[model samples]
Target: MTYPQDPYGQQQPYGQQPPYGQPYQQPGYGQPGYGYGPAMPPQDQGLAIAALVVSIASLVVCTGLLSVIGVIMGHIAHSKAKRGEAGGQGMALAAIIIGYIGVAIIVGLVLVFVIVGIATDWDFD
Candidate 1:
């Protein structure tokens, strides 16, 4: 099969190449002896994403349970980052902090309610 450059002036045939003054271009890995090598595989980000999302949602939704989950996931993600298993250390830390704040808010509200109830002599019975 003849691989002729259709219509266009550039003739990129099978064995033939561009005329002089044109630099030879390799597919992806350039140069000889040294190759670009395979692209780095993406690091696992499940824990990191979960931590951040859960923390943010908890903070906005004011849900203590999700905040706790966020804190747990954050710690796991941070550990993974330390061991070079994953990334997003900053994200994990932020999630942990946010989670703590959410938990604190929840506890604070509970305490406030309890104090108000006792002051008013509210009876559960």
Candidate 2:
């Protein structure tokens, strides 16, 4: 029987193994080729969230030191989350919200204090 020639002219018989000691390689088999594997779970998620929360809260307390720390923590958390290191989305978001609220309160208080001071002191020279 005349076998049909393959594209490479390599006559591969059906259900027959490759030549012995020829390093047989199957198409799309056990090779480390393309496609990704299962996604690994994140680590240190809780820590990141905690940091974010602390930082945000500090802002409201009028403690720049705490706020700075919080900001730094939040940034770290965000980076980890982005890189799939830790699942800290909720914590990071809470931290951000709290921080904003704290800042707003501080600003408002300062504004009120300033306004009150200016109003009470009316010395026209």
Task: Please tell me which predicted candidate would have the highest TM-score against the true structure.
Answer: 1
- lDDT of all predictions: 0.83, 0.66
- Candidate 2 lDDT over residue span 11-115, tens digit each: 555555665554455543566655668776546777666777577558645775566566667777777778887777678766766665666666787899889
State TM-scores per candidate.
0.66, 0.53
What is candidate 1's lDDT per residue for 13-124, written digit by digit as tens?
4456645666555434336664467878788888888899999999899999999999999999999988999988888898899999999999999999999999999988
Name the lDDT value of residue 114 in candidate 1.
Answer: 93
> What local lDDT does model 2 show for residue 103?
62
How high a TM-score does candidate 2 get? Answer: 0.53
> What value does the lDDT take at residue 87 in candidate 2?
79
Model 2 CA deviation exceeding 4 Å by range: 1-42, 56-64, 122-125
Candidate 1 local Cα displacement, residue 18, angstroms: 34
